[model samples]
Target: MARETWGTRIGFILAAVGSAIGLGNIWRFPFQVSQEGGAAFMVMYLAFIILIGFPAMLAEFVVGRKTELNTVGAIRDFAGGYWQYLGGLFVFIGFVILSYYSVIGGWVLRYILGSVTGGYAATESAAAYFGMVATGTDTLIAHAVFMLLVIGIVALGIQQGIELGVKVMVPAILAIFGILAVYAFTLPGAGEAYAYYLSPDIGYIMQNWQSLVPAAAGQGFFTLSLGMGVMITYASYLGDDKNLGIDGISIVVLNTSVSILTGLVVFPILFSAGVDPATSGPGAIFVSIAEAVLDLPFGRVVGLLFFLTVAIAALSSAISLIEVVVSYAIDEFGMDRVKATVIAGVAIFILGVPVTMNTVFINLYDILAAQILLVLGGVLLMVLVSWLHAGEAIEELEQGIGDLGSIGSLWIWMVRVPVILVLLVSLYLGVTGYIDFLTGAFAEYLGTL
Candidate 1:
């Protein structure tokens, strides 16, 4: 059998963007913005995306296209020897991420149903409702259901399944969020929310620059889905004619737009309801924001749209996460796509069971995947592409980017110096104390009453 490739360029671009625009955009990004200094964080994040994220993305693309293999196969084939372990490390990272990621997907699915049934409407407190829902057998059922949806799409193979799924999902995500943003702008306190979100406080940034830069840079990598092998697996299917640099830029632009638009939608709704935007945890969305939505005119309808949009975004990203492992299985072991997807999905589902049952475990898994492994994977990737395989990476990049004369060298140097340095700092922060900070925050939030 022949290897699968995307049917069109737009399909590939949308699929990549779909992977990038997940819960990170809707649930995490807004919270991070509020916590890290609002507009100051946004400015720093955008800078990292351009300087570090885009170049690193191009490096992944070059590796994938050069070898036409999954992460394991690509590294082994391209560099040979001990480098294959790095590939296996990526697979491990993807597995760890999807394990807990599906649990969040399940939560989003529950919210989608809750919005329609007014499940949240009857609750006296959104926080209490979320606490109840976040545990027990019901959460496990939801997680399984969400995992099965991801499996079904991935099992259909690349073009017919993953590509087709994202083609529909990505458009729906943008349209729903766009409509919600427009509606949010009409709310009573929208102007204040917009100012809070868009107005950068340089003094705040200067005072908090040490902590803020690491958080923003980590988010930049996370939001782009750069470190987990999703981009590498997606790019492995690409042909030589496509311009990877241009596609990388497009994906970043679309992903950033969705994230910014989510802030536009979420902040106004929270501000209008007199809810504080700084409730910077999972509860912010499930409890605080949901409670706010219930109080507004036509609140049920708005809630439905919001959760539906999140559900789509979650599914789009979950599909890509599963694909990273599935692609590796197919490429390295020559396993059947259906078998690989089923085995991987079931394993992830089983792994997520504990996460659904225990809030503490859930936080641990999230910190591991989001903070530690993500930055490690990114730093290793930069070293591989920029240092060890620079010649081949540049050659692969030049294949489609022939018209750009000096851009290839510029990309290489950027990856080698600025990108690698930033990723290393991100990893250092995560290792030294960031995990403790996150764990402490989770403890404080979860321990209350």
Candidate 2:
């Protein structure tokens, strides 16, 4: 069977953007901004996305379009002997990420139902309501349902399944987000929320660079869907003569736009309700928004739209993560697409059991996959593409756009020196910071008990 290619250029772009915009942007970004000095985190995140994230994205595109293969095949074919193991690590990263990611996908699904029925609206405390539903039986059922949805889509192959799905999903996501943003801006505290989200605190960043930089860097990688084979796998479906650079910039811009838009929707609501944004972590969206919406006009209708948008966004991204590993199975082993998808989905669902059973495992897997492993993957892949296969990478990059000249040299330089150095530093800080974070969290939990 011939390898599946994207049906159209726009299809590919939407799908790639869909992959980049996910729960990381919608759920995690707001909390991260609140915790990491608000606008200081925003500044650093945008810098990393433009400076480090773009070049790394192009590098992944080069490898994928050059080989027209999954990450494992791309690395193995380009750099023979022992290098394929590196490719396997990326696939593993995707699997691990999706394992926990689907659990959150489950949460989004539950919230969607909660929005429809006003189930959470009757609760005295949104935090307590979230605590009740975030784990155990309800979450396990939600996780299974979400994982099954992902499997059904991927099993249909690229053009029919992933491409067709994202084409509809991405647009709906953008439209709903736009509606929500406009409504949020009309809130009384919108100006204050904007100041909190957009105003920079340089001193806070300087004082807390150790934790902030790594967290921002990790958020950059996580939100952009970098440091995993998702981009590589998405690009593998591309036809020739496509400009990887321009497409990459488009993805980055759209992804960042949505991240900012999510803040527009979230922060205004929180500030208007006089809720503290920093107090909520993973459940920030649920608790803060749930509480805020109860006091707003047509709050249930707005809540439904918001959670509906989140559901679509989560599905779009989950499709890409599963595709990374499913493509590997089909490409390397010549397994049938449907079979590969089912097997991959089942394995990921099983892996997600612990995450659904205990919410603590959610933080554990998130830090392990998003913060630590992702930055580590970025470091290794950057070195592999920019250093090990410099000539081939440049040649592939220059295909759609003629003769990069100074541009090509600069990209390699960015990837080699600063990108690698920054990721390595982030990885180190992430490891130590996560340790302290975990320790403190544990002691705090014990004290409460």
> Could you report the Cα RMSD, in angstroms, for every candidate shown?
2.0, 1.4
lDDT of each: 0.86, 0.89
Q: Model 1, residue 302: displacement in angstroms?
A: 0.5
**Per-residue accuracy of model 1 over 262-320 as CA lDDT, tens digit each:** 99999899999999888866557767678899888889999999989988998888898
Candidate number of the best TM-score? 2
Candidate 1 residue 218 Cα shift, in angstroms, is: 1.9
In candidate 1, residue 362 scores what lDDT? Answer: 62
Clashes of 2: 0
* TM-score for each model: 0.96, 0.97
- For model 2, the superposed segments whose C-alpha errors exceed 4 Å read 441-449
Model 2, span 1-449: residue lDDT tens = 89999999988999989988988898789889988888888999999899989998998898889888998998888787888887898899888889988998888888888888888887778887788778989999999999999999999988899999999998899999999999999999999999989998889878988878898899999988888888888888887799999899899999999999999999998899898988746777788888888888888998899888888888998999999999999999999999999999999999999988877887888888888999988898899998999988999999888999999999999999999999999999999988987999889899999
